[model samples]
Target: MTRTYRTLDVPVRGGDLRVGVWEDGTPGAPTVVAVHGVTASHLAWQLVAEALPGVRIVAPDLRGRGRSNELSGPAGMAAHADDLAAVFAHLDIPAGLVVGHSMGAFVSLAFAHRHPGLLARLLLVDGGLPLATPPGLSGDELVAAILGPTAERLSMRFPDVAAYLALWRAHPAFAADWTPELEEYLAYDLVPDGGGSLRPATSYRTTLEDTVDLNTGTAVTDALAALGHPTRFLTVPRGLQNEAPGLYSPEHAARLVATYPAVRHERWDDLNHYTVVMSEPGARGVAAVIREELSALG
Candidate 1:
């Protein structure tokens, strides 16, 4: 399919926020608004978008990330969700499927809660459920584990985009699954910081705040329980490489299914949190689940 890109500026809480949209398939076809995870931009949906023919796919760079970094806001889930709502209103897209991955899952949940009538279905790709942090783990410690690489990268001034892309390609998380699509997705996350240096578009402060929000799971879990729309939760079997077991386990996912009887839960055994949405195979699996769910909804 031939894909087209466009920029959208929608009014939000404090000011206007920019959204990068990838439009493909048919104009009047059912739309799927994809929300990417923390530290990721709209490009994260590239593989999924390519697989879903006959559907209008819209993936937006959330506030403080990608082209929307300049967008003023609180840099929390509610703020991101509100930004999505604004986009829907501006485009006059009513009642379409909502798909979210990781932090994007939280944003999707929040949107479903705030604007119940606006979503036809909600599909969470290995995220959106409550995650349990070790009780003794301090917020700072958690942030360090999660944002350490980003901090290190943002501190160094990359000589050029190629240099930055080289570093990303060598990263362990993506070492085995690197592809041209993944390269383009990573590129979207980079921006010229200053002095002819490139840096990630997401700010350290926003990254930390997003971490705290995910660790707490306050808004997301509550929103899931309250959401009236049909919802699907996809869980990754392998936890973070450095973390203890049960951090994001199948048991936890089962409990979530029990709590929200309306939620359809599934687990992908071979993928980790990052790979679940980053690789072609993982993205294809997620797309299949989404297709099934949306078909059932129809």
Candidate 2:
């Protein structure tokens, strides 16, 4: 069954936050709130939504990303978390499961910690745990190290959406698994810059600030120690570039699991970080886990 996809702009601190809602349209179905990665928008989760026809999914383009790119400063995990809390209040969803990918996981973590009454369950897809920061690295250095060349693309100019798609089509991580759904996800990232060029909807300053916050900020670190609800962490063996050992290296992963014994951990060696929720096999895996969590809730 083809589900219904709707777009809405929920009010936030400085401006309205864009949200994509995918639902089976069945009243009273289990609803899950999803959060996208740092540089990604809500469209990134469409594949996972398609795999769960009986579920209702809501995803937001965080402040300074996607349609919310127009939003001003005050971007960080705390601000983003508060904005998510507001999103829930605006939608009247007092409590629901939240699944976050990459940076979104941190935002979800902060949200759950600050507004525990709003989140019933939490699932972190390849993120949420405090990253093991290498010593002697500055914030910019850390961002460059973690994001690699993927971060460089944020400053590039594309002639148009087609050109951007071509760039992604050539990417080793996405070329083999590109789909119309993925195309939409990528295309939505483009916003027109003057002179007939385009750039990603995510702002560089926002990305930089967020990188600093997640890696060095207090919200996530403070929340990690106080996570009282049942939480799950899902990780991939490869990263944004399809590089091995992925985000949260083996040592870091093990340390996090040991430190937070209450949080469950699952690892997928075959799936890269991006494909873990953006491809057919990946979406199926993510949706299945979501279904399992939902069942467990009942």
Candidate 3:
């Protein structure tokens, strides 16, 4: 069965935050809130939604990205977490599971910390844990080292959505994973730049702020130190460009799991960071994990 997809503007701090809702049309079905990675929109979870026909997925265009790009104020993990609280309040979601990918995973950590009662369990995909970065690096250096081309693309201007799609189609990570769904996800990232060209909807400054907050700010560190919820983390063997070791090196992933002994951890050897939730195979794996968690909840 084809699940239904829709979007709505949920009122938040600066402006309305655009949220995507994917549902199976089964009344009272289990709902799961999904959070996209940095520089990505709610559409990143579309594949996962399709894979789980029995589930309802709620994802938001975080402030400073996607339709929420117009939202005012500085971006931080705490601010994003609070905005998530607003999302739950507006939707009247008392509590349920949350799946966060990349920066979304970091936001989920802060969200679980700030609004503990709102998250029953957390499924962190390739994020939420402290990244092992070199010391003595400036904020710009940190963003560059960690994000590389992902951050660079935010400053680029394209003549149209096609140009943007072309850029993504050329990405090494999507070389063998390209699909119409991936095309739609990339196309949604473009917005008019006011100069007749189109640019990615993610704001560079917002990305920087968020990058710094997640990597350097004490909120995530503190959250990690005080984690009390049932959490599961999934790491990919490859990264944004399909490079090996991905976000967390095997040793790093193992160390994190050891550090947070209570948090369940797994490494998906075949998928890259982006594909873990964006591609069909990756979505099937994630949907399976979500189903396991939901069944456990019951």
Candidate 4:
């Protein structure tokens, strides 16, 4: 899966933001803009991008993460969607499919609401629908459960990039699935702090704000109901049970499908939240589903 990388500086409300475009496949091919989750960069879609050879993939490191750190403003879904709109304008992308994961899903949904004419369809991977905070679960507890080792790794300051990579290498999630692509992806998230130590690009405050805003699920529900374009909801079995049981469950998804009127819902039984777009087999399956939906659109 060889790729050509180019840095794009998109002008937004506050300042210019950098987006890394991994151009693959043919020119003028239908584009798929890949949006990653909170605390994740463009690398989150490495495997998925590799599998989709027929599509021209445009993945951006969202504001406050990856190459877009200099472009800071508000860190909400609406702002993120606006950043994406700027990316489309800079690239001259008329209209194509939009694929979003986790927080990226929220951004895509918001983008759909704000700029419906910019996207032909949307593929929301484990996001886009309303998420509920579990009963008896504190906000801190929910963050710990959903973010897991990634949060811990982000909190620690590594003495060097090598040390940071070592900690990432030992993660349980990547132990069996580690690849060169994953290594490169991890490298993009680390930055040198003043003390000759590396840290995650995302600030703790940014993460905290996103985690505490789960109660605003009505906004996402309203966005979904307002969306007139073709939409697909891809669910991961594990996160559906662990993070927000009521909201992510199959029954809830079915109800959402009924409510949305235009949404197409499906469940991928084997993959977890991260693996659904990060691993080869999982990405291939997801890409296949997207290809099917895109084909149906034409």
Best by lDDT: 3
Q: For model 3, how does the per-residue alpha-carbon lDDT over 1-298 read when each residue is reduced to its tens digit?
A: 5678999999988888999999878877898999999999999999999988878899999999999999988789999999999999998885879999999999999999999999788999999998989988888899998899999999999998888888888899988899999989888999999999999999889989999999889989898888988999999999888999889999999999889998999988889999999899999999999999888778
Q: Give lDDT tens digits, candidate 1, residues 1-298.
A: 5777777787877777666666665656777888988878888887887777776777788888888888765787777887888889888877878999888998999888878888889898867877655655666677775555645565566767788899887776676788898888777778887778788888877877877876775777668768788888888765444233323676777777787788888776767767787788888887787778778767
Number of backbone clashes in candidate 4? 0
Q: What is the C-alpha RMSD of each candidate to the true structure, in Å?
A: 2.4, 1.1, 0.9, 2.9
Q: List the residue pairs that clash in candidate 3.
A: none
- Among all windows of ten consecutive residues in candidate 4, which has the lowest summed lDDT? 238-247
Candidate 1: which stretches are off by over 4 Å?
25-27, 136-138, 145-154, 239-247
* Residue range 159-228, candidate 2, lDDT tens digits: 9889999999888788578889999999999999877899998877788999999998799988988887
- Which of 1 and 2 is the better model by lDDT? 2
Q: Which has the better lDDT: candidate 1, or candidate 4?
A: 1
Local accuracy of candidate 4 as per-residue lDDT tens digits, 161-237: 78878876666555567788888888888887778788898876676656555335344656776888888888877
The TM-scores of all predictions, comma-separated, are: 0.90, 0.97, 0.98, 0.88
Candidate 3 achieves a global lDDT of: 0.92
Local distance difference test, each candidate: 0.77, 0.90, 0.92, 0.76
Best by TM-score: 3
Candidates ranked by lDDT: 3, 2, 1, 4
Question: What is the overall TM-score of model 1 with all chains considered together?
Answer: 0.90
lDDT of 4: 0.76
